[model samples]
Target: MDMSWPHQSQPLPRRRALAAATGLAAGILLPTRTSRAAASGPTQASALNAAASYANPVIWQDFADIDVIRVGTTYYASASTMHYSPGAPVLRSYDLVNWEIAGHSVPVLDFGAKYDLNGARGYVRGIWASSLAYRPSNRTFYWLGQIDFARTYVYTATAVEGPWNRLTTISTPYYDAGLLVDSDDTLYVAYGNTTISVAQLSPDGRSQVRTQQVFTAPPSVGTLEGSRFYKINGQYYIFLTRPANGQYILKSSGGPFGPYTMRQVLLDLRGPIPGGGVPHQGGLVQTPSGAWYYMAFVDAYPGGRMPVLAPVSWSPDGWPVVQLVNGTWGSSYPSPAVPVPPRPVTPMTGVDTFDGTTLKPRWEWNHNPDNTKWSVGNGLTLRTATVTNDLYWARDTLTHRVQGPTSTATVQLDHSAMRDGDRAGLALLRDSSAWIGLERDGGVTRVVMVDGLTMDGNWNTTGTGTEVASAPVSGGRVWLRATADIRPGAARPGTFSYSTDGTTFTRLGPVFSMGNDWRFFMGYRFALFNHATQALGGAVRITRFELSVP
Candidate 1:
């Protein structure tokens, strides 16, 4: 299977038409991420630290299904979280080059039992491509997305640092939608697959007023979705993604829904990551100086899709053009020139001490957790929630985005409290996963490394696969390390090791090959899991957690 897009030529992105964080302990800054550009790549690509320019995959991590909005000088972006609790992450940026966690739109995925991973049933389902909009008239932010393609969930808050409220659930499904709060305070949504449609929402945006199909793609542009709506200077534009790879724009001067005109904006665009695909789907934002920039994501799996920014230039006739160098999207560009640039933000990568009452915004539960089973003070504790051999069904498996091109994650676990048949440790999680952890059986505890556990279409998985490596561990204190090379060019290793004294470490088990199939949209992640295959009541305490991207 070819994960890297190799057939990108012209008529790329629609030129051929047709379709298409926060909180907790002191900061532990990540070492500068490695940046390697093509030999003939831009001169500044290697100077990622320069203040004047920034590299593509601007913020490298799993910030998939993105929609970015700028409020005054501050830029706020939203991304999809399928099963992770505290879904719809809100990211804040000052200079567009740097971003930090602001908050989340949904405190928990409460629409149904599936979202709670009940029975491990919600595997690859929950929130999909969401549309985020802000209503300046009310100083409120709105987020809309469909769940399981069954119903659209709407949430709203006065600020991005939110105590967001679930406004309503629409029976209407807005698949991969874009939300627009017109100047008159009226709401409009553009959504659908190859055939895009616009719908008018009640002023409160709690209910749909009406719906209309505006445009349908030609047969050539296959699989079009991901709608990002905006009303620019009285013209409405919907930016969409056309895969295997491309981004197209639909413009209408008439109204929110119109007989729209189409153009291709991005196609087969490549970034610094050698095999990474082009950037697309993100909306456009303009700086105070009237400079336009497009923020989009490139498919850099097994680490997941990442956001990239490129400049936008309006053509002589009012069409928007994606700025490119050497006939393709380059690896570096001049950063968005914002007026009164906000102060630099601390990067999201770091060490976390779970001393605070609230989990840092960056940490998300694998699903809507059984909140009663977890707590944080000096150490993060996870009580066994399910007596299942499958970690997929276990609630409260905390997850963090794995950094790219390469990064290492380490966690200290105190397993003294673990009951028999409990597994607790760090993992590189996806549909197929591998983990190094402590497993207790009949009172004997052993550090084990397991791999090749995968789920079927129904989300069933092998409960406790045979361990590849195991060692009897006497002490209750253990440290697990996971290092993954998610460099985008080809498959790489996601290796695991264990430490007893926090100083010396020994690699264990065969290296797990990271999978890069794009169909699993969430990509690979670093997960902290504790689940039971026997009786409940077993638990583990995470004393220290650090993710180093260097």
Candidate 2:
């Protein structure tokens, strides 16, 4: 039963009304650091320094496949949120080093039954690479995204924090798509895998007028995707990322349709740096002062692919060159020169009380959530449902991006309502996942740590599961935690633990290794799920959730 509705004509306005109605009027403004960092522990303040220069991996969390655009003095970024409802997160920043979630382009991804968590499922597929473009011609913002196995869509919003208008779908599948509106008001889309492509959109912006292969990567360049297109100073620039190399820029002095020359503009092929990985897939942004910077991500595993900022300047040959220090990516640089008022620095991961009427913008559902199955009123109550035997197929799992190299997430669960055959706990979710939770079996409650592996990319139960540890428990309340140590050159295993008293924890399972599979496309995330293996099961209440870096 898909019960999702089309976004109302005026979503931002309606959202304001809903916020006021729900007593969230005070939270409508840009998030303040004092309020957001109150419960985030000591690491919150230490993450950023009060100096003119900032460190590399500007955003130390998994903000993968980043696409950025500058609007006057403000910088707006849109990133891929595959299968995470309230998809295509839009982040805003005054200084490039700091960012906060402003809003999402879509309230829900209800394109098909799978996206709605119905009989079918969309795991590694939903909204892939998205391109965010602002056209000064009509004062409109366009967001184009590729929905796997479905047609591409272009969403329009007058304001970035939008009541976006859902436009008609483009019948072509544009993988790693990028949207650009030329000064002449001609709409063009660039995308491809091994072969880079460019297409002209119809005047109405609803269909493609013509498509062509602009450039193809040679066999030497392995795994090329994530195309970000731009037309700057009368030159058409297309950026592509290859795991074998770093990021390359293709420049065409001709037009949107091009006879382009390619150059390796940004490369960190020397492998992982102290706080960053190889620089890859991202967009170029310019400040009001006319300074240019490249925002990209590195494959950081358990923490996923995190964003990094690098300074950019053009060479004598008219090619953009990334400013690397001493033949390597710099660890820190002077912050972007932008004049703005003092704003709070917010951490990517924080503490949740589950007392508000709405979940924080940082939290997202694994899939389009069943609104009727969860609530934040009396703590976060997650009602169990028998969707499938495989946890990846389970719906309504709440998740947050896992923070870098080292971080720990803890959740206090009240399982008084859990029925027999129900499993409820905290998990590190990806193609391969593991959880430490309370399972109800034959009227006996036990604390169990289970590891599940998906053999192929499919969402079938053919995958194997191993019970690492189990112990009988008598209480209706339990505290569970998982710690990840994924620092480059360090042992990469996620350890799970449980506690009867919130003060002290007992190690539960064998250390589980974190994995990276291209099929998933994103890094591992911390997730909360409650599901039944057999029949309709019980509910679990998450009283408190906290994430911290050790």
Tens digits of per-residue lDDT, candidate 1, 1-550, equal 3333222211122112211011211211111111111122223322222234556677888897789887766788999888888999999875676778889998888878877776446766777889788887888999999988788999999988789999999999999999988867799999999999999999878899999999999887777899999877677889999964799999998988798999887677666567888777787776544556788888888889888887777765666777775566756665554443334455667799898898998898888888888899988999998787777777889999988788899999999999988889898888889999999988999999998778665566754455899988888899999999987755578999999999889999998988888776887889998998878898899989998966
**What does each candidate score in C-alpha RMSD?**
10.6, 11.0
Candidate number achieving the greatest lDDT relative to the actual structure? 1
- Global local distance difference test of model 2: 0.75
Q: What are the runs in model 2 whose C-alpha is more than 4 Å off? A: 1-51, 117-119, 218-224, 271-277, 457-459
Q: What is the alpha-carbon RMSD of candidate 1 to the true structure? A: 10.6
Model 2 residue pairs with clashes: none
TM-score of 1: 0.89
